[model samples]
Target: MSYVTKEGLGKLRKELEQLEQIERPKITQQIAEARDKGDLSENAEYDAAKEAQGMLEMRIAKLKDIISNSKVIDQSQLDTSKVAILCSVKIKNKANGQELKYTLVPDTETDLKANKISVHTPIAKGLLGKEVGETAQITLPNGNQIDFEILEISLE
Candidate 1:
């Protein structure tokens, strides 16, 4: 099951709608138009259209499954005492005293550019359930370990 915020769920729904309503018909028309050119053995346009349609259908199916299994989390009732999904955490590196902030979100809502890290990532996994003033040691994918001290936690 996937856990997502209301905003994330809305975004998913919008994307699904676009694929089903707009894209589906567009592809169907392309397939029909390609088929009109007749020879089944040597039609490149028909083959390309069919391939694109298959990919789009697969993507639509995956989105539908995600939307059906997802649950929206209520941000207002979240506990800010410890780090958890949807919590914005501020941490300082133990070695260099460098500070960085990240928001722990579900896999579907992760946006690296926006400082949102997926809960399944190494850093987020290590920080989970940690409170302010606590230190967490996280192992990177490259076999390096780093210690970070939790400076603050908030709902933003």
Candidate 2:
């Protein structure tokens, strides 16, 4: 099971709708058109369409599974005293004196461009259960360690 915010669940539903309603039909049409061209043995378009259809079907299945198994988290009930999933944490890097804010979320809701990191990530894992002003030592995948001072934790 995966935890997601309401907004994340909505986005997942929208994507699933697009795939099922629009992309599925489009791929079916492509397959049908390819089949009308020539014999299946020598038709490259038919083979390519078949491959694309298989990929699309797999994606649709995965999305359905994810949506069915996902649970939306209540933002209002989230605790602001510690670093946890769905919490926006502001941290100051001890090494470079750089301050960064990241919202820790589930893997499905992770958006690096939006500064949302997965709870399973090294930084988030190290900061979990930590309160404000606590220093968390995070070890990266490359074996390098960095300490961050938690400045604030909020629901937003």
Candidate 3:
């Protein structure tokens, strides 16, 4: 089972609704239009439309499964004692002296543009359970290592 924040769960529900309400109807219309072209034996548009619809349906089913198994984590119940999921961690790169803040989140909720990294990432894994003032050495995907010093940890 995956754990997600309330906001993340809301986004997932909204996406599922859009797929069912808007995309499903749109794809159905496409299929009907392709069918009107006649000659099902040689119709390229009909074949393509059917393929697209199948792919969309698969996506919808996968999203539904994820939503059904997901659990929303309450931020208020979280402890601030150590680094963990849902914690906004502030860290300073030891070698470059650059400071970066990342909010560790579940895989489905990861948004790189928003500074939210997946909990499975190398950096997050290395920093897990680390406290403020502790240094964590992360083995990157490329096999390079970098150390980061934890500066702070907060719920938000």
lDDT of 1 at 81: 98
Candidate number that wins on TM-score, 2 or 3: 2
Clashes of each: 0, 0, 0
Q: Which residues of candidate 3, in runs, are more than 4 Å off?
A: none
lDDT by residue (tens digit), candidate 1, 75-141: 9889999999999999999999999999999999999999999999999999999999999999999
Clashing pairs in 2: none
Error of 3 at 10 (Å): 1.0
Worst 10 residues of 1 by lDDT: 40-49
Q: In model 1, which runs have C-alpha deviations exceeding 4 angstroms?
A: none
Better of 1 and 3 by lDDT: 1
lDDT of each: 0.96, 0.93, 0.94
lDDT of 1: 0.96
- Angstrom error at residue 19, model 1: 0.3
Kindly provide the TM-score of model 2 when superposed on the true structure, using C-alpha atoms: 0.97
- In TM-score terms, candidate 3 sits at 0.96
Report the C-alpha lDDT of model 3 over 50-88, residue by residue, as the tens digit. Answer: 998998899899889989999999999988778999999
